[model samples]
Target chain A: MPLSEFDIIARYFAQATPGRDDVVLGIGDDAAVIDPPAGQQLAVVIDTLVAGVHFPLETDPYDIGWKALAVNLSDLAAMGAEPAWLTLALTLEQSDEQWLAGFSRGLSELAGQYGLQLVGGDTTRGSLTVTVQVAGYLPPGQALTRQGAAPGEEIWVSGTLGDAALGLRLVQGGLEAGDSAAEQLCGRLNRPQPRLSLGIALRGMASSCIDISDGLLADLGHVCAAADCGAALQYADLPLSSAARDLIAADSGLGDLPLIGGDDYELCFTAPADRHTDIQVLAGQLDCPLTRIGRIEVEPGIRCLEQDGSPRSVTGQGYRHFNESS
Target chain B: MPLSEFDIIARYFAQATPGRDDVVLGIGDDAAVIDPPAGQQLAVVIDTLVAGVHFPLETDPYDIGWKALAVNLSDLAAMGAEPAWLTLALTLEQSDEQWLAGFSRGLSELAGQYGLQLVGGDTTRGSLTVTVQVAGYLPPGQALTRQGAAPGEEIWVSGTLGDAALGLRLVQGGLEAGDSAAEQLCGRLNRPQPRLSLGIALRGMASSCIDISDGLLADLGHVCAAADCGAALQYADLPLSSAARDLIAADSGLGDLPLIGGDDYELCFTAPADRHTDIQVLAGQLDCPLTRIGRIEVEPGIRCLEQDGSPRSVTGQGYRHFNESS
Candidate 1:
C-alpha cells in the first residue's frame, strides 16, 4: 500500500523543517513566506535529479537528498549569494519510512550546517525524482556572474577538480583505485560541500565566476564566451588531487579525466592582475586551496600549454547526458 | 534515450524567458537572480501536478499548464501579493512538440494576461509532473494571511463555490448536469481564475484571506484555527450558479459535493461587519460577485445552519490526490 500525500509530507518534509524566524509559514499552508533583509535581492536556483539518469538506481536516499540541495546551493555560491530558504518537490517511487527518515535527516543536517531554511514544498507519488528550488540573497550589485572578465585578468579555482566524476566511475565498477583514494573520491561524489560563505566573501573581489559543474574546461568556456575573451591555461598549474593523479597514472584509460569529467562543484573565478595578492591572502583564511591556473587574454580562442611550453588543445568531450541517449 | 539538460530546457521552457533587467540572469546560467523593490517582501508559493494524480492521463497539456501556474498564482493572491516572477521544474515522460506547443501557448497566454514574467526553472527526464514556484512582492505589513481573522468579523467569498468540484465530477462522468452548467463547471475546474488584482485591492481590508483550493468549510477552518475563532455559516446564502442548484436537486450525490469538493480557487476572506457594503461596491468594479456566507463567532467551534434554522455540520472533505493511491 502507498502512503497518502499528507502522511508523506508530515512524516518526511515537515519533520525536517528548520526552525527559523524568516519562515513565517512552513510546509502546511498554500505557500511559504520568508522575509529577507530589505536591501538584498533573492537569488533563486532550481534543479532536478532523476533516478536512472542523474544517479544509479541503487544510490542511497540520504546522499540523494544531500546532493540535490548541495548542487543548488553550489549555484548560489557561484552567484555570491548567502544561503536563505529552500522548497522541495519530491516524486517518490514508494514510501518507505526508513528511506524518508534517512533522507530528511541528511537534508536537515545539511540545511542546519549551511544556515539554510526549508520553507515549503510539495510531494507526489511518481517515479523517484527530486526537485529542489533554493532562494538566497545578495546585497544589491554584489553577485558574481560569468560576464565580467577582461584582458590581463588571472583565472583561479579553489580545490581540486573532477573527483566527483571519478568517484562515479568507481561506483559503477568500471574503475578502481587504492582503498583510501577510492573512498575519498566516492565521498566527494556522494556529498559535495557548497562554498556559500566563501562565495559571499569573494563577491566584490572576483572579476568573474563560474562553478565547475559540467567540467573545468567546458564551464570556463561559458565564462569566456559570455565575457567575450579568450584564455590560456597552464597544465602544470592545474589543481589535481594527488589521489586522482595517482589513480589516473595507474590506469592509462583515465587520462584527461581531470579535464573533462563533471561534478567538481568548485568555484572557478577570474580577478584583475593587480588584485591577485589580495585574493591569495583571502584564500588562506578560506581553508580551501586556491590555484591560479590560467589567464584571460584579449584573443578569442583557448590555448593550453604543455610542460614543454608547446601549445595543446585541452579538449576532450565533456560529460553529456543527452549524448548517451541520443 | 536520454536528453541533454540544455536541450531539455530549450525545448520546453526557454521560450518563457522574461529577458528584462529585473532578471539579472536567466535560464542558461546555474541560477537566476531577480531584483526586488527595496521596501517590499517576496511572497513565494510552490505546487506540483502529477499526471495520474492531479489530472487524468489523457487530459490536454494546455489546460494542465494553465492550472499549474494558475494555482501558484492563486497562492500569491491569497496573501495579497502581486504576481511578478515564476520558475517551473517540469519532469517529462518525453519531448512531445505538439503537447509542448499547446502547453506553452496556454501558459504564455495566462502569464501575459496577468503580467507575470518567467525567470528560471529546470527541465528533466522523468515521470510526467509539473511543479511551479511563483514569487511576488507584498507591501510591507500589508500581506494578508489566514491568521488575522477576529471574532465578530463577517466572512466573504468571491465568485461561486464548488463549481470546480462539480465540473470535475461531470468531466469524469460521475455526475451529469445541464449543458450550460456542465460547460461552465468544467471550464472552472480546468482554468481557475486567480484573483490577484482583487486580492491586492483587499490587502489592508480583509482581516484574513485564503484562496479556496480546499473547500470553503475546511479552508475556513484554517482561518478559524489560526485566528482562534469559530465560524457560523448559512448554507442558503452560498453563491451558486442556478445550474449547480438545479443539478443538486436532480441528483442525490451532488448534495455533499459542494461542501466537500476542492479546486475552486476562489477567494475566501473575513472583514469587519461594516465592510460588506464596501466589498459589494468593489465587487461591482471588479465585475465579480461577493457573497456573504458566514460570520466569525466568539465560540471556538464550527456551526452551520439551513434557511429553516436547522443545525448542520459542514463535511468538507476536499479531494486529496495522495489519498487516491492509498
Candidate 2:
C-alpha cells in the first residue's frame, strides 16, 4: 500500500521531542505553539532548496536534507541567535519510503545537534523542493546585523573558503581533485557547517556579520552596502583549504574561485581593530581558525587587491539566481 | 536592466511595514527579529502551494500569491492565534516583472488586511512554488485544538461550503456556472478569507476547531480522530451557496459536492450546545453566518444523516494530496 500523507508524517517525521519545555505543542496540529524565553527577541528565517537549482538532481537524499537545514541554521548563526524550533514544507515528486527515512534521519541529526524541535509544516506532492523556516532567540539588542561595520574595522572570517566551490567544480568535472581531497571537499560542499557557537561568541565583539552563501566578495559587498562603506580585501589573505589551494596551484586562472565561488556557509564579520587580540583568544576558545582578510573603508565600493596592492579584475560578483539556469 | 534577485525583492517585495512595534527587524537581514507580545505563546504554521498541484498551471499570479498566504493564515486562524509575522520562500521558473508585481500586490493586500508584516525570505529559481510560514500569538492555555471536543457537542462551520470547490470545477470546465455566480465562486476559490476574528473569538469558547481545507467531512474527521469520538452530520443542514444549490438541483449526483468539496478555508468547529447562542451572536457581529450542521457522538466513526433520518451514501471523502493527481 502507498503511504498516505498522514502515514508518512507519523511513520517518518514524528518523533520524541524530549525535554523541550518551551514547546507547548509540536507536530500533528494546525500550528505549533512555543513560549519563547521572555526578554529575548525571536529570530526567524526561511530558506528554500530546489532540486537541480539549489542542489544537483543526483545528490544523495541524506545530504540534501542536511544541507537544507544547515543553510537555514547558517542564517540564525549569522544573527548570533540560539536555534529553538523549525518547520519544514517538503514537496516531493512521490513518497519513497527509503529516501524519506534517510532524509528524516539526516534532518533529525542536525535538529538534535542544535536542540531544535521540529514543530509543524506541510507535505505535498510536487517537484522536489524543501523549505525550512527556523526560529531562534537572542537577548534584546544583542543580534549581529549587516549594518554595523564602520571604516577602519577589520574584516574576519571563520574557517576556510572556496573548498565547497572547488568541490562543486570537481563534482561537475570542471576540475580534478585527488581521491581523499575530493572526498573532503565534497563533504564541505554537501554538508557545510553552521558556525553557531562562533557567532554567539562574536555577538558583542563583532560589529557586523553575514553568512557566506554567495561567496566571499559578493557577501562582503552586502555588508559594505548595508554599512554604507567600501572594503579592501587582500587576495592573499583569503582562507582556503589545502584542496582549494592545490586546485588554484594547478590552474592560476582559477585564482578568483575563492572570491567568486559561494556556498561556503562560513561567517564573515567585521570588528574594531582593538578587538583583534580578543578575537584571537576567542578563536582559540572555539577551536576554529579566525583569519583577518580585509578592512572596511570610507570609499563606497568593494575592491580586491593583489600582492602589490593592485586591483584585480573579476567578471562576476556572486551567484545571481536570475542569471543562472538550473 | 534585468531584475536580479535583490532588485526583484527591492522593487516588488520591500515595502514599509509601519507601526508594528513587535517587529524588531523586518526585511534586508539574515533573519527577522521580533519581540512577540509578552506572556503569549507563539503559534507557527507553514504551507506550500505548488504550481499545477495546488492550483491550475495557468492560475493568475495575483491569485496564486493571495491563496498561498491565505491558506497559511487560515491555519493560524484555526489555532485561535492573532496573526503577527510572515516569511515567504518563493520559487519561480524565471523572474517575470509583471507577474511578480501582481503577485506582490496580491500578497501585500492580504498581509495588510491581517496586519501581517513581511519579514525575511528567499527567492530561488525553480518550478513555481510558494511556501509561507506565519506566526501568531495567543494567551497561554487559550488555544483551540482538535482534541478538545466531547460527545453531545455541536459541530458548526463558518461561511458557506463547496463554493470554492464549485468555483474550481467551473474554471476547470467540469461544470458550467452563470456569469455573475461564476465570478463570485471563482473569487471564493481564489481569494479565501481566513476567519481570524472568528478564530480569536472562539479561542476559549470552542471545544475544538479546524480549518476546512480538505473539505467539511474530511477536516471534521480530523477533529473526530483527535478528540477520539465520532460525528453525525445532518445532510439537510449542510450550508451551500445559492450557486452550489443550483448546480446540485441540475444534477443530483453533484449533491455530494458540498460534503466532499475542499478549499473552502472556513472554520469547522465544535462547541458546547449552551454556547450555541453565543456563537450565533458572534457570527452576527462578524457579519458571517455560522451553521450548526452536526453533533459529536460517542461512536467511533462519522455518519451522514438524511432529512428523513436515514443514512446517506458518500462516494468521496475529501481531497487527499497523495490520492489525487494534479
Candidate 3:
C-alpha cells in the first residue's frame, strides 16, 4: 500500500532538522509556535517553484528542494535578515518515498547550514510545486531596502553574476555538456549562495540592496526607480567567472546574458563613494568578492557604458512571468 | 500585451490590506519587515489549495481566495492564536484580470475583518494553486495543544458539522440544489467562519483542541493519539443544523457524514468535566454554539454509542490525502 500523506511527512520531514529552543512547537500539530528574540524586527519572504516553469522537469528532486529554500533565503539576505525559521508547502504528484527522502535531505541540509528550523507546512497531492516562506530577524530600523539609495552612490555586487543563467542554458541543451565548466555552471544554477554574511556586514554601509534574481539590469532598474535616480554601469568592470568569459569570448552574442539573464542570486547594492575603503575591508574580512559595477545618477534611467564611457544599448527587461517570453 | 507579474501585484494585490504600525516595510521590496509584539509566541501555519483537488475547477474565484486564507486561519484558531500577518504565493494559468479582481477582493475582505496585514508573497505562472502562510500570536504558556487531553475530560465542538460535506455534494451535482438549505450549506462550504474569538477565549480553558477540517472522527482521533487516550462520542449528542437533519432524514445513510465528512472548519476540543458551566457561559458570551458530545476515555480506540448506550458501528477515518478513495 502507498504511504499516506501523514506517514510520508512523519517518516521523511518530521525530524528533518534538529529542534531549536525558540521553536515552542515544531510539526505534527495544527501550527508551530515560535519565540522571536526581543528588540528585533522580523523579516519575512515567500517564493514558489513550479516544475518545468522554475526548473527543468528532469531536474533532481534534491536540487529542487535546495533551490526552493535557497531562493527565499536570498530574499532575506537582501533585507539583511538572519534566517530563523521556514515553512514549506509541497505539492507532489505522488507520495514516492525515494523522492521524499531526497527532497527532505536537500532541504534539511541548507536549512541546517542557516540555522533554520522547519516549523510547519502542508503536503498534498498535485503537480510538483514547492513554496517556501522564511522568517528572519533584523535589528530595529536597520533593514536594507531599495529606497535608501542616493545619487552618486557607488553600485556594488557580491560574487559573480550570470553563472546561473549560463547553467540554465547548459541544462536546456543550448550549451554542450561533458566539461568541467558545464558542471560548475550547473552547480551555480542549482545551488546559488545566499550571501547572508555580506548583506549583514553591508547593512550600515550600503545605501540600498537587492538580490539579483531577475537579471542585473532589471533589478538595478528597481533600485533606481525606488530611489528616484538613474544608474551608469561600467560594463567593463562587471565581474565574470573565467568560464563565463571563455564562453562569451567564443560567442560575443552571449555578452548580453551577463546583463539580461536572471537567477544569479547575487546581491546588487549601492553605497556612498567615501565608503569604498570600508567596503573593501569588510569584503576582505568576510572573504567574499565585491566589485563596483556602477554609480547612481540624478537622471532616471539605467544606462550601461563601454570602456570608453560611451552608451551601450541593452534590450529586454529581465524575466517577467506574464511576458510573451521569459 | 498581458500584465507582467509586478504590474499584476501592484494593481491588484499591493494595496490589498491597509498598513499596520508593526510592519516596518510591506510590499515592493525584497522582503517584509515586521515588529512582533513583545513577550508573545508566534504560531505559524501553511496550507495549499490546488484547483480541482482542494476545490472544484468551477468554484468561484472569490470563494477560492476566501477559503484559502480561511483554512489557514482555522489552523491558527485551533492553536488559540490571534492572527497578525499572512503571506500568499499564488500560481495561475494566465493573467486573468477578472479572476484577479474577484480573488483579491475576497482575500482583502476577510483579512480586513481579522486585522491581518498582507505582508509579502510571490506570484508565479503555473497550474492554479494558492498557498497561504499565517503567523499569529499567543500569550505565553496559553496555547491549546492536542496533547493536553486527559481521561475524564469532556469533549466539545463548536457550531454544526457535515454542512460543508453536503455543500460539496451539492456542488458536485450529487444532491439537488436551488433550495435555501442548499444555499446555506454551500455558503458554509465556500466561506467557513474561523472560530478565532472562541479559540482565543478558550486559551487557558480548553485542555486540548483542534479545528475540524478532517471531519469529527478523524480529528478527534488525532487528539486521542496525541494525548494517549481514547474517546466515546454520544451519537444523540452530536449537534446538527436543521437543514442537515432534514436531509439526513430523507436519506438515512447520510447520518454518518457528520462523523466522516471533512471541511467543517469548526473547533473540536476537550475540557475538564468540572468546567462545563464555564464553557457554557463562554459560548453565550461569544455568541457561538458549543456542544458537549463526548468524553476522553482510558480505552485505546474511538467508539460511538446510541441514545440507549448501545454501541453503534462507525467506519472510515475522515479525510486523508493520497488515500486510495480520498
Candidate 4:
C-alpha cells in the first residue's frame, strides 16, 4: 500500500505546468517537444545537486526536489529566458514512498508557477543525485549575458542577501535567532526562492546579470572577468533584511557574512546610469526590492569599502564541493 | 602538467561539435544556446551507460564514449527526427589522462559525423557513468510515434540485430569466434551504428518505429503494445550478421541468442504492407538493409514462430539493469 513509482509520479508529480500552446509533447514522452518561437534562441542549462554536497543530508526531500529544479530555473532566469521544459536525471539511494511524494509535491508547485513542463529523463539506482537540464527561449539577440556591463554602469541586486546563509548557520547551531525569526530564516535556508520575475524584468534594461549562487562577491567577480570592468561596492548601501541584520549584529565572528556566504539566489545585475530609475519602476511594479549596492568602473578590479572608508577584502565562502567536507 | 577540467574540456570536448547556424552557443560558457528549427518539434532523449553495467569494465573508453552518444542518437532516430545537438554528463571515477584522450577523440568523431553540436552538460566525480542527452527535430505533424502502427502493417528491421550482443559475449569469453570475426563483433559491441539514415528515410513511410536497445523481441513488443496491436514474427526472416550466426551455431547453451540479446541500435519499424517494395528500395538507396521480419495482427500480443509451422513462445531474455548488479 506504500507509494509505488507510478503512485508517487501520479499523485504529486503530475502535470502542474502553466498554460502554453508551443508544447507539442509534454511530460509523457521520451522528451518534451517544444516549438521554439521563430527567430528566438533556446537557452539550456543543467545543474546537479548531490546529497551531502548541495544540501544537508537531513534536509527535507521536498526542499531537495524543489531546489534542484529551482536552481536550473534560476539559470534560465539569469539569461532572461522563459523556461519551457526540463529533464530530470535522478539517481535514488532507496525508493521511499513518503520522501518521493513530498519531493514531487514541492516540485509540482514550483513547475506550476513557472509553466515549465517535466520533459523526458531517466531514473537510476545510485547514491542520491538530481540533475536537471532545463530549456528556455530567449528572443533573438536578447539573452542577458554577464559580459555586457559597461564601466559606468550601476550595479544592482534584487531582494536581501545573507538570509539563506544566516539560516544555514542557525540550522547548524552556530548562530541564534529569536524563536519567531528563527523559523523564517531556517525556511530560507531550506527553500531559497529563485527570482524569476526579476530576471524577466531586467532583460533589456540590465547590461549584464548573474544570479547570486556563489556569494555576491564571487559571482560578481564572474561579471567583472567577463565584462572586463572593475567594481566599487558601497557596503552601507547593501540592503539587509532586519532579520539578517539582527542575526549578523548578534554574531561578530562571521566576517562579511552577507558578502561571502552564498545561497541567496537573488539577481545581481548591472545597468547603464540612466536606467536606474527605470529599474526602480520595474522593481516597484514587481514588488521586489532593488538595491543599488555598487558601480562599474574602469579600474579593472573589485573594491569593497565601508562607509568609514576602510577597504573590506571579502573572500569567497561559497561551498566548494571537494575542498570542504561537511 | 595534467589535464584540469578546463583543459580536458577545451582539448577534448570544446570545438569538437559540428558548427551549425542553429547552435548559437556551444561550450565554454555558463550554458549552450540553440535554436530548434521553426515549425519543428524538438525530440530529446538521455541515456546513461555505466562502466561494467552497460559494457565490459575494461572496454575501451573510446568506444564507451561513442556508444554513449550513439544510444541516445538511436532514440531520436526512432522518432524519425533529424539529429541536431547533444549534451554530455560525464561522471568519472578519476581524471585519468589517457582515458579522457581516447574518449574525447571517439566522441568528437561521432559528433562531427552526425552534425550534432556538443551543447552543455555536467562533470562530476562518481563511479564511471556517462549520460548523453540528444536533441533532434521532426517537422510538424510528421514524427512517427510508437502508437501509429496498424494491425495489417508489415514489420521491418533495418540492418541486422543481435550482432552487438554476440560481439559482447565473444569478448566476454562466453562464446568463441575466429580472431578477425571476434574483432568485428567486438567493434559492433563497442561502437553501435545507429540507423539514423534509415530512420530519416522512413519518416513519412513508416507508421511506427523503435530502436532496438532491448532485443528485437522485447523492443518490438514495446512497439506492439504501444500501437495496440499484435505481431507475428517469422524466425527465419531475422536479419542476423554472419558473426551472430557463427557464434550461435557454435554455442550450445546460449539459446536463440539473437531473439533475446539486445543493444543492436537497429531500426525496427512498421509500414503499410503495400509499400514493402518501396521501403526496400529506399533502404538500398541509403545502403542500409531493410528486412521484412513480421506482420501485425489484430490480436494484442507478440507471437514468434519457428521455420517449422509450430508456434513458439520464447523465453524473454532482454537486458534489464537490475539483472546485472542490483
lDDT leader: 3
Under CAPRI classification, how is model 2 graded?
A: medium
**Would you estimate the TM-scores of all the predictions?**
0.91, 0.98, 0.99, 0.92
TM-score ranking, high to low = 3, 2, 4, 1
Clashing residue pairs in candidate 2 (N, C-alpha, C atoms within 3 angstroms): none
Best candidate (score: TM-score): 3
Pairs of residues clashing in candidate 1: A325-B2
Question: B141-230, model 1: which lDDT tens digit per residue?
Answer: 787888888988999999888788888878889888778888898889889989988899898889999998868777888889888889
**Candidate 1: regions farther than 4 A off:** A1-27, A297-305, A309-316, A320-323, B1-4, B7-21, B175-180, B298-304, B311-316, B324-326
Candidate 2 lDDT, B72-188, residue by residue in tens: 889999999999889999999889999998899889888888778888889998999999999999999998898899999999999998899889988899889789889989999
Give per-residue CA lDDT, model 4, range B132-245, as digits (tens). Answer: 888888887777667788988999988877788888777788777888888887887888888787777788899888888879887788788877889998888998888777
Candidate 3 residue-wise lDDT at A209: 96
Off by over 4 Å in 4: A1-20, A27-31, A170-182, A317-326, B1-8, B28-30, B170-173, B321-326
Q: Is candidate 2 or candidate 3 better by TM-score?
A: 3
* CA RMSD (A), model 2: 1.5
Q: What lDDT score goes with residue B17 in model 4?
A: 71
lDDT of each: 0.82, 0.90, 0.91, 0.78
